[model samples]
Target: MKSVTRSLRILEAVAQHQPVTVGELTKLFGLPKSTVQRTLVTLNEAGWLRANRKDTTRWEIGARVLAVRPAALQGSSLFAAAREPMIRLRDAVNETIHLSVPDALQCMVVVDRVDCTHAVRTFHAIGDTSPLHATATGRAVLAHLPQADVEELLERGLERFNEDTPTDAEQLRAELRKVRADGYSVNRNQYRPDVCAVAAAILDEAGTPLATVAVSMPDSRYDATRLPELGRLVAETAQEIAGRRDGA
Candidate 1:
C-alpha cells in the first residue's frame, strides 16, 4: 500500500512537471537517488511512465497512463451519457462522429467515436488530439473556454499542420469569435485537405462547455450548399447530449 501511494505521488509529480529529469524527481520527492531510480523503473515497467524517447534524461507520462480515464472529470460523466446520442447522430448522417474535450495539452482529445461505414469517411481514433485552430471539434470547445485560458493558448503559438491551419493568433481569435456567434464550428479542409467537419459544444448545467460533438466526412462528399443544415444538425445533437448531462 505504501508503494502504491508513493507510485501515485510520483506519477502526479511527473504529470505536473512533465519531461522531468531523474535528478529533479529525486530532489522533489526528498528520496535518495537510488530509491527514486528504483521506483521510477518499477513504474516505467508497469506502463505508468516512460523515459522521453527524444531525451532519455527526461521522463513523460506513458501511453497507458493517458489511456486510463476515470469515471468522471470535472464532476461530469460525459462519455457514458454521450454514447447513444453519438450513435444516433452517426446513423442519421452516416458520417464519423467524435466526442472531444479540451485537454491539458491545449488541444481537443477524442473521448468517444462512432465509426462511419462508408468507403470514404473521416476517422479519428479515441485518445487522438487535434489542434484548437485546425479542427471544428476543437474550436467548438475552445470558443467557450474562459478568456484567460484562450489568451494563454494563443500566446503559446499555433503549430501549422497544413497550409490551411491558422498559424496567426489573431486569425484564430477572429475565427473563434465567429464560432461563438454562429453557435457551431466548421472546419473546411483545415486539419486535412481531404476532410471537412462541423461541431457544436456540449454545456453542463451552468452553461460551461465540457465537450464537443462533431461529424466529419471527406471533402469529396462535402456539400457547401448544405453546410448550414449540417451545422444545425450537429448543434441539435450536441444540445441533446448537453440536456442529458445536465439532467444527470
Candidate 2:
C-alpha cells in the first residue's frame, strides 16, 4: 500500500504541474531520479500519463486521467440542484435523465439516472464529458453561449463521437441557431447509437444557461409519437427550475 500511495502522489503531482519532466517530478516529490522514472513508466503503462509524442522528455496526463475529473464534480451545488429534477424526470418518463454543466471546454455530466422500471437503459456515469456538437444537453447549453465563445469552441474543432455526430462547424452553428429559436435541442444517435435525447437549458435569474437537463432513451422507446411529449416536458421542467431561481 505504501508503493500505491507513492504512485498516487506522483499522479497528483503531475496533475498539479502538467507537462512536467521526470527530473522536475523527482525534485517536486523529493524522490530519487530512478524512483521517479520507474513510477512515470508504470503510470504511462497504466494510461495515467503519456510521454509527449512531440517531445519525449516531457509528459502529460492521458485521456484516462482527463476522464476522472468530471466524476468529482458530482458533489457540487450544480449537481445538487439537478439531482431531484433528474430523478423525477427519470421516473416520469421511465427512461434515463442526465444533468450536465459546461466545464472549461466541454459539457460535464453532474448527474446520471435511470428509472427502476426501465429494463433497457443507457448507463452513463456522473463524470462523463459529451461532445458539444453531439449530445442534446451540449447543444442546449451551447446554443445559449455568447457568439464569440461559440466561435472559439468551434475553432478548437469538433470530434465525431458517432457516425451521426456533426463535425461541420457551419452546420452545427446553423443547428444551434435553430435551437436558440426553438428553446430546446434534440439529438438522435449522435453520441451513442440507438439512443435519443432531448434537452433544454436551465437558466439562472439573469437568463444565463447555468446547466442543461436531458432525457434519454432507446430510439424504440422514444419514437416519433413520444418525442414531442418528452421534449415538452424537458423544456417545461427547465423553465420551472429557472422560475424558481428567479423567485428565490
Candidate 3:
C-alpha cells in the first residue's frame, strides 16, 4: 500500500508539473533518487506517464491517464462548444477556470482547466474527482441532475472535507435549490481552505446539466463584494456553452 501511495504521488507530481525531470521529482518529494526514478519507470511502463521527447530525462502525463475521461470532452462537439467560452471566462476573470462533469455518484470529475497567470492559483487536476458538496462545479452540476440522483448521493453520505464543506443532506439540498434559483453556485474555501470557486451549469436541450464551468482563485484574492459580478460572468459563460447543439 505504501508503495502504491508513493507511485500515486509521483504520478500526481508528473501531472502537476509535466515535463518534470527525475532529479526535480526526487527533490520535490524529498525521496531517494533511486526510488523516484524507479517509480517513474513503472508509471511510464504502465502507460500512465510518458517521457518527454524534448528531454528524455523528464516526464509528462500520458494518454492512459485520460482513458477514463468522458468521450464528449475530447475534441468532440461538447469540447468545441465549451472551449471558447471557458477560455473567454478565464481571460475575463483572470482566474483558474474548470470544466467538470458529474459522476453517477457524489463526485464531479474535472475534464478541462485553464490556469490563471497569477503566481498564486488553484490547480484542479484533470481526471480527478472533487466532492459534490464541497466544490462549486460539483454543486453546479449536481443541482441540475435528476432529483433521484441527488437523493442517491445523499444516501451515499457526504464526507466532510473542510469546515465549509456541507455534510448535511438537507443543507446541501437547500443549497441546490439556491443554485437552481440563481443559476450559479459558489464555494468559499469549501474543498481546499485556500481556494474559492464560483460555477454555473451547462445544460442540454433536455434541460439536464451535462457539465459545469467554474472560476476559482486563491482566498487571498477573494472578495465577498465581488461574488455577484463574478457569479454572473461564470453563469453567462455556462449559458453560452449550453446553447451549442450536440452536433456543433
Candidate number achieving the greatest TM-score relative to the actual structure: 1
Error of 1 at 198 (Å): 0.5
Model 2 residue-pair collision total = 0
Which of 1 and 3 is the better model by lDDT?
A: 3
lDDT, residue 132, model 2: 76
Q: Sorted on TM-score, highest at the top, how do the candidates line up?
A: 1, 3, 2
Output the TM-score of candidate 1.
0.76
Query: What is the per-residue lDDT of model 2 for residues 141-198, given as tens digits with 9 covering 90 to 100?
Result: 8888888878877887898887789899998999899888877899999888888888
The C-alpha stretches of model 2 lying farther than 4 A from their native spots are 1-76, 243-248
Q: What CA RMSD would candidate 2 show?
A: 5.1
Stronger candidate by lDDT (2 vs 3)? 3
Task: Give the CA lDDT, 0 to 100, for residue 175 in model 3.
Answer: 97
Instruction: Please write out the lDDT profile of model 1 over residues 1-248, one tens digit for every residue.
Output: 98889888988999899999889999998988888788889988986788875588888887555445533442455776788899998898899998887653346777778898898788887777677878998888778888887787777788888889988988888999999998899998988779899999998877778889999999988888987888888998889898887677
User: Which prediction has more favorable lDDT, 1 or 2?
Assistant: 1
RMSD of each: 5.8, 5.1, 11.8
Q: lDDT (CA) for every model shown? A: 0.82, 0.77, 0.84
lDDT of 2: 0.77
Winner by lDDT: 3
The clash count for each model shown is: 0, 0, 0
